[model samples]
Target: MEADLEHYLEPGVGLLQDNASGCAWKNAAGKKISCAARETEALVSDLMVDQPLLWLLVSFSVGILLGKRLFRGN
Candidate 1:
């Protein structure tokens, strides 16, 4: 809330309470922006969205492989 982030970094104080989501926007060459706790669901969705067709093909292949195996002896 101020020019400096001193209060946010104060000792014995929590930045995010009650499981709130927060983000820090920074600009630095070759420096990654820090983030809050990671979420598996978000990461997976990102992966799927990154290469939708590829993931679709992969899942379809697996499904066909499983179906063949399961129905082969039937």
Candidate 2:
């Protein structure tokens, strides 16, 4: 799962520059509030809906790993 770092680019150095503003849920001058958890849930749900097959395969792999770990002594 580890990725090679030799070919990594410095972020915001080329055409893919990042915006100066932070996530919309952050407060720059007032009391801090966040919807990060809800936003993350929505993002994951969107990904699952968009790629059902990928999610299915990932879930199957996780289930197999858990089963092996839990029943390894049997």
Q: Tell me the tens digit of each residue's lDDT in model 2 across 7-73.
A: 4756454333344455444454333323666678899999888989999999999999999999999
lDDT of each: 0.64, 0.68
Candidate 2, lDDT over the whole model: 0.68
Each candidate's TM vs. the true structure? 0.40, 0.46
Looking at model 1, report the run of 10 residues with the lowest lDDT sum.
28-37
Report the C-alpha lDDT of model 1 over 1-74, residue by residue, as the tens digit.
44376565755335454224433343332134232224556787898889899888999999999999999975
Candidate 2 clash pair list: none
Give the TM-score (vs. native) of candidate 1: 0.40
